[model samples]
Target chain A: MVKISDEEIRKMVIARLEITPSKRKIIIGGAGAFTKKELIEKIKQHDPIGQKIIEVHLNYLRSFKKQQFWG
Target chain B: MIITRPNHDFATKYLFRWSQTVITLAKKRNILVIDLKGKRASRVELTKSVRKNTADFIFINGHGNDDLVTGYNNQILVQFNDNEKLFRGRIVYARSCRSAAKLGKSCVKKGTRAYLGYTDDFIFYSDAASKFLGPSNLIAKTLLIGETAGQADQKAKDAYARTIQRFENSSVSEKDRELIPYLQWNMEKQVCLGNKNARLKI
Candidate 1:
């Protein structure tokens, strides 16, 4: 396994989230919904929601790595 | 059937509206529904309703964490080691974030027949809330239609898989395709605790 710094992972997650449309809003539990721009700012701020988004992205990547998709 | 719909913030508002479909289905199935909507979704009301309707299947829609599920304005409704015992002998499907991690387990330990919920934060997109909710609602809808808790859990996951598959298609718009990750997250996090064979009595 390749060792990546936490900063690198955060950057990767933020970059991936950047491609999402600006109008799109994702609801993350009680923190409510956030647009891509807001999420990016949160990521930069390293708030709980930002960390959550990072975790979510990492989890999705792991699923992709395991080929968990039906296809 | 007792369902709580807390329409306070954006997240709860979406859940509140989307969960109406399950209520409608319950009524159509001739199941009596005790709806705790808005301020009525408080812990007091939920406790009273549960005590009164001991066998009512509970469908909770709100924000939550590993040890507790909330209602309107984030009021704590059920919590681990607090009032989870109230769910004993009843089936509960909590469409809230992370409650299954601790609260659901506590409920099961306290004798809840079956508890279905997410082990992680339950997420969805605002533009496609209804589509996401369609699968989420299946837990309660399937139960109301006489499926066991385990079967309802599988049916909901299958619905999520079908939705994700549809979005994975090349013909689908990129905007819609963006929803697949969140869909997969919810599907993977959803869990059925206690007796998988437990069926609703009401």
Candidate 2:
């Protein structure tokens, strides 16, 4: 499967969280210290923590669908 | 007991605010609190504090990975590679990322009585427009009220379940439902290793 674009990933995360970047707080793995836009930009850079942040949200996404994860 | 509270950013500050009640409860029980706040929350200060006391409990709240727990300015307060020696004979509970993945086992190997923490990121959410304490109240109350480590771990899991259920039943937006998976993930990943029945010597 082709990987989603960073923009799409950001939108998916924001839609999943239902929080705007301007006034909300989001805590993730590597970019836990960054805000919405900052976190998106950080993740876009493919940093290690940023990758983990994306992977965590993806894990949640998958688990919410299959109702189970790495057991 | 030592609590590493670093409020240098938004998420840390949010967690720090949520933990005010737990801090008060521990103080009420006369637990020795080596609070690492602001600039004092550095590796040097943490090492000194841990070395200076025969403290039985270590509770850290910050960002971390499988090998370490960070502090103010993301300084490594405890890392498995370098700081495993400091946690011997202690019960460690890290509310950070993945410290339990490797650091917890390292502490157990280094002779800790028990280590309780999340194998994944300890995720949380809040109403940006309102205040929500999340599970900190119940989890901390149960875990710090002199219960066995195993019991405390179970209580925390139960609290997580109840909180998730509450979120499901609430009339929040659909996107908010995504938060449930994270809560469930945290509940399932939070683990206890070594002595299950250990208790803090507070």
Candidate 3:
């Protein structure tokens, strides 16, 4: 299977939404209400590639939030 | 360099030129050329060939809609029909426009590391520009030579930009200049929807 990385998700989401990085952060933060696994399931319902990508983006967002709080 | 250019005569001319370039490049890199144009090969046939030969990279050039590429008959659609087992590891460059949309997710599910194409209805002009820019050939060369998808894509973009620069340098009418910008804009809007550095693992 194709391993979708965080950078790939970032580029795909940015291109799909035609938004900037700040806007991506906002949309991802809103979407991050669910866990990485849950987001993957939801995204898979639409597109498998999208599912893998969303999982990567969710992981990034989760870690970013954690880092923001801890560091 | 397997190719399939159907009824469109203008597109066929462009495809032939592009195929020659790819074949020459592949020869230089010691890659075999599996030419399949005008053979009326169906998706099933192509799938079988893909299964038989584990190609490092696959490049398809033809007319396409959001769902599939047009085969000889309008009733048939030429696409990568291999299940996860057949094409467990490969990178694909879909020269057909809109073949990389959400509908192409199955390609990745079937184990393609990267699939590059347009996200929307790309026009014939943009298709012509892509040919002139050699995005398909560039992608093939990069993948076969062990470069990342992003690297290949960047090279393709640079090639395209260089073409635009050449057009800008040439003496052209105002109307043509206006059209050139539109073409560049459309090309920029084309999105690559896969992991740039990811390699398919069978």
Best by lDDT: 1
| Backbone clashes in model 1 | 0
- The DockQ-based CAPRI class assigned to model 2 is acceptable
TM-score of 1: 0.95
- At residue A42, candidate 3 shows an lDDT of 48
**Runs of candidate 2 exceeding 4 Å displacement:** A1-22, A33-71, B126-133, B136-138, B170-172
Chain B TM, every candidate: 0.97, 0.89, 0.76
Model 1 chain B: worst 10 consecutive residues (lDDT sum): B50-59
Task: Give lDDT tens digits, candidate 3, residues B1-202.
Answer: 3444443344444554666667677778777656655545356666667767766566666656566665433323444452433434667666665667753566777666777766544332322335343654676567666678778777766665665555665595443332343334335535555678954222
Q: Residues B1-202, candidate 2, lDDT per residue (tens digit)?
A: 7778888886778767766777888899888788877778788888899989887887777888899889888988888878787888888777787888999899898898888887877655545312223454444566678888888788767766765666677696654555566666677778888899888765
Model 1, residue B164: distance off in Å is 1.7
Name model 1 segments beyond 4 Å from true: none
Winning candidate number (DockQ): 1
lDDT of 1 at B29: 80
Instruction: Estimate TM-scores for all models.
Output: 0.95, 0.78, 0.60
lDDT of 3 at A13: 46
Better of 1 and 2 by TM-score: 1
For candidate 3, list the clashing residue pairs, or say none.
none
Off by over 4 Å in 3: A1-71, B1-8, B73-87, B124-136, B165-176, B198-202
Taking the tens digit of each residue's C-alpha lDDT, what string does model 1 give over A1-71?
A: 78989899889988888889998899888888899999999889998899988887788778878988674
lDDT of 1 by residue, B77-138 (tens): 99988988888888999999999999999999998999999999998899888778888888
How does each model score on lDDT? 0.89, 0.72, 0.52
DockQ numbers for every candidate? 0.73, 0.27, 0.02
